[model samples]
Target chain A: MTTYFNEMYDSGKVRPPYARLEDWTRSMPAELREMKQAEAEALFRRIGITFAVYGEGGDPDRLIPFDMFPRVFTSGEWARLERGIKQRARALNAFLVDVYGRGEIVRAGRIPGRLVYRNAAYEKAVVGFVPSKGVYSHVVGIDLVRTGADEFFVLEDNCRTPSGVSYMLENREIMMRMFPDLFRGNRIEPVDSYPEKLRRTLASVAPTKCERDPTIVILTPGHFNSAYYEHSFLADLMGVELVEGADLFVEGEYVFMRTTEGPKRVDVIYRRVDDDYIDPLCFRPDSMLGIPGLMDVYRSGGVSICSAPGAGVADDKAVYTYVPEMIRFYLGEEPLLKNVPTWQCSKTDDCKYVLENLHELVVKEVHGSGGYGMLVGPKSTKAEIEAYRARVEADPGNYIAQPTLALSTTPTFVDEGIAPRHVDLRPYCLVGERVELVPGGLTRVALTEGSLVVNSSQGGGVKDTWVLAE
Target chain B: MILTVDHVTLYRYDRPVRGLVQSHRLMPSTCTGQRVLNWAVTVTDGLAGGAFRDGAGDWIQGWSVPGPVSEVAVTVRGTVETTDQAGVLRGHRELTPPDCYLQSTPSTRSDLALAELAATVAGHDDVLDAAHRLSGLVSEAIVYTPGATAATTTASEALALGKGVCQDHSHALLAVARQAGLPARYVSGYLLVEGDGAAEGQEAAHAWAEIWVRGLGWVGFDPANRCCPDDRYIRLGSGLDAQDAAPIRGTARGTGFEKLDVTVAVQAVQQ
Candidate 1:
């Protein structure tokens, strides 16, 4: 009776798009599969692609699990997803622009004014100034989950610096290296052009002060950061310099990277540093990882910050409820993808219902990321649920609850052959001169037998998502 | 009444520091009672960045001076013509709603002392009357002492000690006002005290608290001076706390023993 919608199959019959993958999976032996898994791990380690696990006592840099099995999608399915992602990104950027200036959406009574104005994520510093090209979130990573063959829902909107594109690119690289024949036979679209596209996107949003070809640099919080590897990798791939806070300085209405050849004017900074630590003068004064006058220059239009400060408000979980309204309000189009039915604990009725059915609903902190502050209802025990309920009751406004979504499963290669595991996709939609995205995105697999959490920090693995060419 | 101000702040370090970046909120308030005749804020050897009028309706400008320069002088000179309207500020263009100020900051967080202070003026029905009562009560509670409290002192700390400066007065007022269900903020501006009074040497640039009245919008109250702001007060900027509304916020690169010398002269100009 426990039927999970597997992307590759429909009642034991192989879907047309996944037939090739099925044949390949059957042809490979158990020993070869084991060897390939080790090979993938070795490749990942050698390439130095690792994520930092915070608050853990052990090694900080843990390699995200890599599965040899790739999740495939037909061109038709991909085309719809591409449209949805682009639509969502455009709407999100527009929302950021509006919230910072005038807040027409708030005035229109579509979204509650308190949500946009009162949210802690809403940075008051960046208000009233629009960035170059009016683009707020230049790079949008939209997290999507599938329920059925045609049912996809947006799980979250990461308008700020969304990491893990390196995994996407790296997964494909290893896949192509390991199974050269599978790629040659299958007309799969290449995702290798992402870095070039990212570079172009950053270049397109250069500030007005640039007299020459704009200098674009990646602003990293330094090597100790969890996504430092991704930062360096992306910078290398884009042919741009990866800079720390100390490596850059703001001078005379512009940001400059300190080079041996004196200071070079930096027009665009693809900053990986969070909003609070981007500028010490404007935000947290004690932040060591921030340029002193970076925000001053940015507000003055000397340099453009990709995914501008305060764009986080648009992606805040409380604001996520209005994304569909945003799409309609700004784009004048119906939302391409549906959002999961979420109950904001800020609402008294929603909070009451969540308390009544604590074990049946998954509750998450509104501002939490990386899957740290969450309670998966079904998987939790009585003691855990009781503790979480008390916490939620203590501060209901900080939490949001949703039904345990029957997340679609994919045939993933585990130790005991192939088994269905939950998966999610984070498509990096680039917004600059125009909204653009690579065909396929990073597909995170839960790896565990019945786990629904696909976050890499939570024992989840990544797989190559193949979008078949027409 | 036209008041001319000369504010010169010098920072001298024991060792050569790297550099300094500063944002100044020195522009005169745009309310009806106060009009700027002339104003200029300059830094020695500093490169001018971009200038912007912030959401709080304050003119802010950025400046940066390069490294290895030991001494930096930030000089602010201005002349403003002020017409007294009984401390009523009119024609200011702040976009933020009053409710935003209700959100208490770390420095203005209310405690047992603040709750008791708010209780002193609890019976007043009108918010404006209650705000005035709260302001007067704060002045009575915390005796004005020049060096009694540090800049990091919160309202509760000052209330417990029973003595503080203008910054502490503003913090205490903000905490108590918020506790009394009135939206309040810390305001930084130049208060022109005519003649050689106690506010002569280097303390003309003052801090106050503004409470949002239901019918009257934002009304300034200076608990340190035991009076609401009049034409003599040239409001520059306001925020949830004193630090956010700092007239000059900066980050000096490099570390050393920094000796700061400040001189602010606010004299009434007879024109």
Candidate 2:
């Protein structure tokens, strides 16, 4: 019988940011709204914005269900969020440098040495090497969820090539074209400059090997990857070439891309391929998706890799708990954003508490994503809880438990008129010479009733998020 | 003692590949007991890519050959002065923590055979004693036999078979030492083995295990020789296993089978 806060309504009054949307929802007819939804689907299909899900039947290109209604955020709320995100981004980059250089944080006794030194994500090859511009995660996506107007918690940190900005930009593009009237009186912030800003951010971190303007290219694992659309989309928008491994080669410590004119030296690569598959000579030798001798050129400072290799160590779920301490230890300031209270099952006491209270807590794998390999406690049956408890007991370090919060909801046009669906926000923050972010981000909603998981891989949909100007 | 080394490795392909990329770890040791004098690593028909000194105190260089070529030769010629410190390696510029070496790789993962070998040192009072004891156990368990195992064989497989080359000996030592809670790694290097009846005779190349001692830093032990690495040993590099610490790792484009032919000569100079 727990109550969830409605973003549009409180005490029978419409929220200020959502006041205009409330009247629009009441005035619009059901048939017209349904027609608009179909039109939105057609636009998205024509644009070829489909996410390929692995191991699925029929077609792999499943359209990420897009909702017609837009989620609204006020200027004041976004301003605070922007500041917090920048602070978090700065702290994340500083942690990466410190861990790879002097081991200051581990020596200070703030974090356990075993957790970092023994982590699978910790790359020993890049030890004692500082990347160009001292930035590790040039782009970070902080997935956040809200419980109330003043209560927000960061659910996850995507530090390594977070892949949803293209969707964020496309959502706004379709929204503006579909409903020009909605933006007439509402001074909404524009996010169309994200591609240009991203290009600038990448160019600022070019390696010292660059003589003239740095030649930047987006390295993709190829069309078979699930995020191929985002890779080609961003490359096209940024006016950069989308290349595979065969298109590039290493010659005398520098990378060169093959062209009809001739071989051109590439100074910067915003690669979407994983670290294990980025270099065949240094990493997995059998990998076909990686360029040979790429790591050697990278380590010698001939080229720059955006969101540098080994950046995933910070995004690990176990490392996520120490971010507040990182903010304090590195930035010398308190965290503006909040973290969800997490019970690390690695600790004996926490494991015991999680075992005893299995039915009320949400359990997630330390390295799992896309709504896979997790247990949402309240909705799970007793048999399911017992089965999950055994897994937690077997390997406590691999699991973390959290108390399920009543996630906030927004009204949506469903088959039976306006209904509420759970929602979460993922704001992409760009870090480079300057830490900045586009005002709004990708807002994902769970289409199932009373479902809190909003991952696109699951039965979730995306909505256009709008931030009003002051 | 000053040791002079002239090593050459050739990778011959049945058909010429489109491209040949290589990363070479054929640099001389720069530790306290060893000092390099006029060391040079050259490649035939290959463009020098990039070079950097790794945290493990080894200089790695990259090379790529634009081909339709048949053979690639990697030549290493160096002179290194060494002193016997009872297997204690000093002045190595390694930045990784000792505990990080405790992490087991697929090639060094301990199975029941390795577990049994590790159990011989159970209830041993001292860690250094246990490390030496485990090394001695691995040497006794697996005799030096040429071609009994492949280069990629796991330590457990070698122990079960009870006979292997120096590569298997190093892997077995790594597996048992890690099981006994001692941080250990595989060391790829060259040893001065003169005369006939050499161990495995893998073209004068040798592999050993280095374990972290409490009071001492890192100490190298050659289980194949049943002794510690002396002034005759020249440490090239170290990693979690044989493949990771390979002196030469590379990939060639196009479909072609590769045949490796290597010859190494390590001689002591009267200095």
Candidate 3:
């Protein structure tokens, strides 16, 4: 395996734009290093950075592991990535609109309705409601991995409350102090404007009847959610209240949030809760994280929710295969970014091919994320592969197979020294009246050796993403 | 033909709780073709809560907890409905239709408009076609942004902003259907899917809508997916909109936030 640092720096493929990186590394005293590490841990705890482990008993709070080194991207590289993400989000949104609004694609036989309907994320509740700007996925996080210089592949799509943007901001703050000289020497673009951009995007969705300054709030599932810290952090940075389900109510054709002064009219809500749990009356009747009758208010145009519910139908892994076609069909533009090679199990030919190549392909459950329900063919035992094969045979419609490519690696801090770790980047895009891409993104690293899972739910860690100025 | 429905749910918490209590009342009905087969109630107060049902026939399930009780008690009631067609079952409630009152109001809520829309679309070829058109339009129109709107979102508001949750979708369709003079109602049900194992945060209780047609009487339509209800759908209850047949409805004591997770599964049994 190639050593990421050696290949990037010593081999001259890429260099740390920070001129003082070497100097800072040499000058770092043992005591200072220890203090910095201690400080990093403290910052995470102070910020309450955490991710929920599904079955892990007791406290669901697990600090998101952070690395001191921030990944750097030049202005040119960032520009390409920005355009690519925008184009991808636009296309995906368009695809959702077409799939749910019109059966044109399905009629044209490019995709199948059975596959779309079978997708676990598809909601039958949101049939005819149109959003303010004709945008379904307001906040989109597209995970990308670099295979080589100027070569990146789509890893995954997080259209529903994609998190870790706050971590990107917080990580940068800690890294700046840890490597002040390096940061000062580098031309890293400031990611501090993200909260402002996000606020603007959310504010743009405020109801028309509201005053010039619409009351906006961040609806969270509360402190137990793994991304609770990010939710509170973003709400604080954006100057909005962080509200849980009980904090809001709907009545008299308007959506009101329970505040210190009783029910206050809220014009916009930046919610981090999943669609199913957003409104008890509409999606999940038993969900306590949602406000009853809230959906009625949204449908009445009394308020606007960011990244509207049921948008997941578009981001469904089964529907992901037709994104490029959707972009061309809706926007009349070619996709700026390319999707990873994916095979739909619903298709007879695809299923046959996937079944035949079970031992060589990576199989993923259609509705799964956070690296769950995935089988790494090359790394699996014969028994595991056989079980997966049986599962696929039993329910071919629930799985998708893809060839396992050598995911690109980056230099990650380890006990011995900086070693190569597979990494992926998820940059968030905000779409309200317009699309805004944050300068930096969440850089997830596969901490385990030879492991492709970079989700925090797995044993993955993260680093700050730095988009450098030209 | 006799129709039976069973909804089983299991809820697990991160930590064990001290106490738990749950209660639910069924919708008062006087339909002749429907008969209660078997009713069972169970609650696990410590760490996990589970409820199960076994029997036959078309049934609508509803739950209501009176107060903020922690221990989960789920009541499973089965209703057998006799149908003229073989292997084709139907369940109907002819009380004061909830949508009638909502439609009577000259309000501009999205539910009214959506009901009106559903009614308008119901005149189309089939339930599948109408559902497809409605779902497609809603999906195209509404941007999926969380916290944008809540359950009480009005038809005018959702139509104006074009955003909302399943309640909004159901209400909007109900409004549109009412406007078009169609007897459309809301449905609460469990969608059976693969990947919903015990471990992986793999469970969700789902809601949709249903329209009563001439020949078909009442048929299921999912505007969210733009399709007619099929095998994957497990019907629980139907009402004017989300409020009437809410799966779990009741008041609670705690003032702060209350977290809830519901997992439902319906498996086809071999005779």
Candidate 4:
């Protein structure tokens, strides 16, 4: 296959934005070059840029693989992507509100309720509860992959507790030193404003009579979580207290945080914990990460929590199919973005088609994340396809299928030299009074040869996304 | 006079496990003509210590203590009543034609405020007039849809969209009352129903509002049923809102989702 870098460089479509990087790569001495990889790995360990591999009884932490070469987007290309992301987020938010509140599209018989509600993330607890600003999934990270220079398709939506924005921020810090020349001359937009935007969104929902300077807190499950670095990073950036569940309480319809002085009123909480772990009273009674009466405090208008509980109902894969219709129904505006064609197994006709086309399409479990219970069409064994077919037939609502397009690839520096690897972009958005996109996002690369899965859990690596100036 | 009340709640998951539980109790006492309020709470969950936040942005750390059983329970009972209202007798009067004291009439600020809340306005012309306006507005604004909201829904969110569940209705009324400068609090207790009920399910632990009235004292309002809390109402606890008076509040040690089922039964006796 023609390498992405060679094609772009040879065609002169755009002079390599980081032409100076070529010198940085070539100038290193042979012995020093071999040692650079080891030095990079050591730095990653020292900085604690690692992920917890769940279910690994011992030695759970593994260093996140970082690519030496960064993927760059020109100012023109980034502008289009920015707009596309905003459009996609707005549409998805509308879809969540509609599905939970009115079911207009479901009543119209376009999407099936059985498919939407059956997903584990779909919360019956939030059916009629509207958020303060009429917004759900305020922070969205839409994963998109490119097949060619300008062609892109959305892979999935990560609206519920999306991790890795921290990775994006941390990756940039590391990249600046590793490839200083490439970053300095490229004019990449800075992603440092994300924490500030996040803080503002949480504060926007404070109760009416709260103190003028409302105390904001970031609620986390503590240091054991895989995304603990992101939690601490965000807390530091926002200049707010990082609180565990035990550090908070609900009294007289108000939420208070245990501080050095005493119980202080907490106006807004940017809760990083999942819904089931947020309030033991409302969700899992066994959850020690949640406050007993926290949900009641929120209900009573004594406090505000970001993204709100039960917002996950819309991000269910089945709900993704109805988003375009929801955007039109709620906003009266056409969706500027398009979704990858999906086959809903709940529909008999679609399921029939999917079963017949199993060899050419990707099959995914509606509720699974982190690349679990997924089948890559072209790579699947015949027996595996037959087993998946049986699973789909037994519980049609649990599955969805789509054509496996060749996800776009970028030139990544490998041991053998630069090679083509599938990559995807997940830009983070902070929706307060308006939507704010962090300049750069997490660009995930499928590290294995010809592998399409780019989830970090699936042996994927990451590159720093550069939104460059024109 | 001062009095203290204690509240206790229990929860059991499908699985067996010990957990942490937190609660706030309001206890009331009377001496001469004054009433005093006292509160106390205990939280026990996890190996890590627990803490509580007060109105002043302070933390009161909780020590780790061993608990018994897989099912978790939290209890909060406190007492609070106006000191000046102590020993005051409230006599019951029958209606020849019961005058509506709760109704907001002439569309005055008081009337508007009354109408804005979800309360009974059947007797007092003033409150009745306002009740008509508020109920009409709510009915028009919110389209009845199941699974749109829960008991914890906020008022502003619901009103912005002009729709919500029972909790949203109560919250909207509460917000309007607070905006109108009325000292109002959320009340969670039980509603006594006669015989069998509708198919929507049995009346569970219900929520309403209690607004402080100058002469009448704290009066009950049922926004969900658009009536004054009457014979069917069994008052539990009063707080700034629902969070303060939740029947059950606690924490557990699991990492997955939990299913909760609540049942409330209230029986009325006549002498």
Candidate 5:
């Protein structure tokens, strides 16, 4: 068994960044701790923040469990991470523009042509047309995992409308409401300006056709979507209209939102809908959720779309391995973050090794999300491993395997008392005219014992992440 | 050769619609093979919205009609000068890689029959020769029979029926070419069928297949005619399938049953 790195404690001593947390936890009795946990859940429910898990027949509006223990990172530590995150965001945007325009990276022979052009996410419609400010993926969510004291590895990149930002702000709000004294003692940076920054970032990329103040709106798939709460919350915070596909129409040259007074032209749309359902004329003809002739207007510079269509191409699982190479080629700088060593089963040698080491690796599908259709080697039963091996063998190109990472852990309030649980972080990096990232991000902790997966759909709980001020 | 085209499409709805939006790829392509002397596309009571050149080098134009109307008419008239260099598309600028066309859409997906048809081209080491053989096989497999297949018919279905129109023939050729590891796409354009060419479906608006040859770029092949596209072929646009490469795509808001009528005329003009 491998020993895990504890964030709060270092070889039986408290780490400097979490020194104050020790006294706060010890001073609170078990009853108060239990009461606080209950209070956090009530607060979350009162605010009507619920995450709907896909494929699970439980409560559709179930509240994601919240942990009271805050994940802390020192100012010095965050400075490096912020730089790395912003750099990665810039590189990702550069890669998107490159792939859609000339595919210079592919011609350079750094990445294979099949991976970029033949991927399902690559949109042929948006080729040769560049969005305003040359930015695709306006909001880049980079999932990061910590191993040793200073080793952080990127698990994946979410380029197309990554959800859970509402949780980030809500967690901080609930924490400040419950522990006012903790905020006074620690000089933690506030993430309240995130919405304002996001609004400005979006407005900065308004279409050139707009002569006056550009009107921005959030296009949602409606209240039935899993991330509906986040869409409405962000719209409310940003002071923008939240409209559905029916509320918007393609008229003349631009998209317009139907209002009580009259029709209003929308300049920029922060769409939460996927590429396939954004425009019926350009993509899936059967999609009722898309505006007709929207792609024509977009290509002609009549409007701007946040996280431009075809941005998903850069965030594909098979394409993730080339991100570091993209950073070097596009920015002419070394990558600040490290990518986990991955074995693509598409290769002959890699497939053979993955098949042999089925019990020592983690395998995931190329296009799957939400932690579905994956195999955890050490945690799975022998029958499950064998079953997954057959699936991998059936389609080698669709599977990729990675070694089981020893994820770091943080102290958590459990039924038996405070114990260590695995955790991960996802920071939402905003890219527009300028690259920006709030000091703090959402920290997800595995409530179950010894679990490395931190996806909310997979029995994971969230906590408030704090970045100290120098 | 100078070819003139007159194309008109009429759409009638049982009930009035709130609005209608349309995207058109009707303009002749710009390349060494074809030169547009004059062209115009008009819609009844419609406003020209936006226009741009796409990655596939097709000029796409948008139009919208605020409707409470029962009928809409779209008209296109153009004159183009053509000189085909043996069906090779030369001096055409496009950003999308050939690898993108290798992807199979619903109409071009290969079945077991298509895979077996592709196997006949095995051991033909020359890429251009292999492409020609695949085109010939598709021609021999599906006989040209007008009204035999609908617009939604897939390549395999057409082959199984052994009878189809130009669209089915192109789709079948695309499927077999892709199955043989050659990238292919559907090309929509005007074909001036006269005399001997009339047996080649005699359709003014024609569809064919273009396979990518390593040294020659994109080469056009009309499996329905069992011949390569020449000066009589005026290329408009290309896509993964017929629906994607359609000259006009439109949607009208309202619960109205729609009826479509189209007429196209292509003639050789005195140079």
Candidate 6:
């Protein structure tokens, strides 16, 4: 039996960051806590922010359960995480610019050439084209998990348009609305300025062709998409027009959005659409969701795309193993955050070890996400382990295994009472002309007892994360 | 050798579209093999958009035509001086690494037969010799027969049928070369065959395969003609396959049935 770290208490003593929350929970009666949970759900439904993060493909209208217990981190702790995340964002952008340019890292033999060039995510269309401000992933979402108070590891990176930021903003709003007195007592960092900061970050990377104030728009796949609510929500908050593929057209040297008055030139597009569906003439010929000839305009520096096309190459799971090496090669600095020790089944030695220890390791597909296509060693039955073993044996390169991490737990509101459940944090780090990160992030709690998967698609709930001021 | 090229493509839509956009790689390549004296590309009643050289050293241009029109004609006329360096592509400025070409597309993916053919080069110690053997094997595997295969035919299909055009030959060569662990790409260009009926009819829009040799960079091999790209071959651009290296890629808005007619003429110009 593994002993998970309890973030709220160490040796039965309340931690410093969670000290204030101890009395707040103790003073609240059971009925009052239930009512507040109901109230938080009502507020979320009213605001129409109920949608699954990361397009998990479950009920789009289903409201992810909201826990009233707020996860707290001290100013001192948050300061370190901020530095690490921002440093990671900078290094990621630097790697993108380098790979798309001379590929100095590959030339220096730090990373394999086939891993960068032959990877499915490496786009041939955007080979030599560099976006403005040299930023590829405009918004970098780093998913972090903690084992101890000071030991945190990055699970993976969401470089190409990470969703769930709307949840971060809305969770804080609800926490403030329900507990006004808590705000008066504690000095928590405000996350209301995220929209404004995101707007500034987008506008800062506008193409040089824009002679005046750049017109920005959010390009969404459509209302039927799983994250359509967040797309329109972010557009409304950022005060930018939300448009689809049909609402945009390509003219001479630029992309233009159709308006009521006339066709307006769009300088920057925060596209929620995937790269394969963003240009018909360049990528898939059957893609009706993409503007024709958009790649030509992008390559010629006529417009800018947030999270520029081909940015997915850096976040690929096989490529994810080298991000720390990228930090060393590009930034000349040691990585602030540690990567989960991974064994790529592609290697003969690693595959041999993983095959024998199928009952003790967590195996995941190289390209799968949202807690899908994974086999949890301890939780899975013998039949499940055997089935996954066959899959791993069939294609060793498609799977990677990592030791089951002892994920930390936070005090979560349960049906019986407050109990400790495993949790994870995902902070949105904005990288444009400057690197910026809001103090707070979205905290996901696995509602099931002893469950370590914190994905919303896997019965996980969310909590309002708090970064208290010093 | 000086060569002149005149190519015309006519697109007739049954119903007039709202508009049409096209990305073109029609301009001749810039390398030691070819030098363009003058070149012009005109799309009927179209506005020229952005123009830039791609990482593959191809000059790409964009054009858009606002429609309510029935027919659009794209005309290309250029004069290029060519020299043969024994099929070696030298002095070509390209940013994409040679290994990137090893990636396979649907048209260039290998099948069992292709893999078997790729194994024939096992005894050759020299990569150049091995590449030449692969080209010779592909030329023998698929005989040059026009109209036997369509534009969408894959290398596997062409190898099985044993009859195809230059596109199929090039795709087949790309498949076998890549399967043999050699980086290869499809090269599209014009072949001036003097008075040959095949060159004037079906082979004018010629395509070949270029294999990456470690010391020699890229070396051209024309399996259809059973020779290397010489002074008679005017190289335009290259890609993973024929569709990727196509001179014109276009999309027209509004529901309309489109009909295409293309005619190309390549003539040797006396200096």
Tell me the tens digit of each residue's lDDT in model 2 across A1-470: 98898888887788999988988878889888988899999999999999976545557778999987888889999998899889999999999999888889999999888878788888878887788889999999999998999888999899998988888999999988988898896889999999999999999999877767999999999998889999999999999999998899988889999999999999999999999899877777678888888888988989999879889989988899999999999999999999889999999999999999989999999988888889999989999988998899899999998889889999876788888899999999998788889999999999888999998887789999999998
Q: What lDDT tens digits, residue by residue, belong to model 4 across residues A299-382? A: 545677777776787777878877777667766777666678999897899999999999889999888888888888788899
Q: Model 1: per-residue lDDT, tens digit, B212-260?
A: 9887889899998888888778888888898889888887889867899
Per-residue lDDT of candidate 6, residues B9-111 (tens digit): 9999999999999999998888897889989999999999999999899999999998787899999998998998899998999898888899999999999
C-alpha DockQ of every model: 0.66, 0.77, 0.03, 0.06, 0.85, 0.82
DockQ leader: 5
Candidate 4 achieves a global lDDT of: 0.64
Please give the C-alpha DockQ score of model 2.
0.77
| Model 5 stretches astray by more than 4 angstroms | B196-201
Query: Across residues B52-101, which tens digit of lDDT does each residue of candidate 5 receive?
Result: 99999999999999979789999999899999779899888898889999
Candidate 3 has what TM-score? Answer: 0.66
Q: Which of the CAPRI classes, incorrect, acceptable, medium or high, describes model 1?
A: medium
Candidate 3 chain B lDDT trough over 10 residues, lowest sum: B48-57
Output the better candidate (3/6) by DockQ.
Answer: 6
What are the per-residue Cα lDDT tens digits for candidate 4 across B1-271? Answer: 2333344444565665433434332221112232334444443352223233322111223222233435543444444332232212133211110111122211112334334443443334454344334544554555444477665555655665666555555555555554444545556655555554334443645666655455654555665665565544444444444553444444444442455544444443332
> What TM value does the first chain of each candidate achieve?
0.99, 0.98, 0.93, 0.92, 0.99, 0.98
Candidate models: Cα lDDT each? 0.88, 0.88, 0.65, 0.64, 0.93, 0.91
C-alpha RMSD values across all candidates: 1.9, 1.5, 16.7, 15.2, 1.1, 1.5
Runs of candidate 2 with Cα error greater than 4 angstroms are: A55-58, B120-125, B195-203
- Model 1: per-residue lDDT, tens digit, A135-221? 999889999999899999999999999999999999999999999999988999999999999998989998877767989999999
Worst 10 residues of 5 chain A by lDDT: A246-255
Q: What interface RMSD does each of the candidate structures achieve?
A: 1.3, 1.0, 15.0, 15.0, 0.7, 0.8
Candidate 4 matches the true fold with a TM-score of: 0.66
State how far residue B227 of model 3 sits from its true place (Å): 25
Give the runs in model 6 whose Cα sits over 4 Å from its true position.
A52-58, B195-201
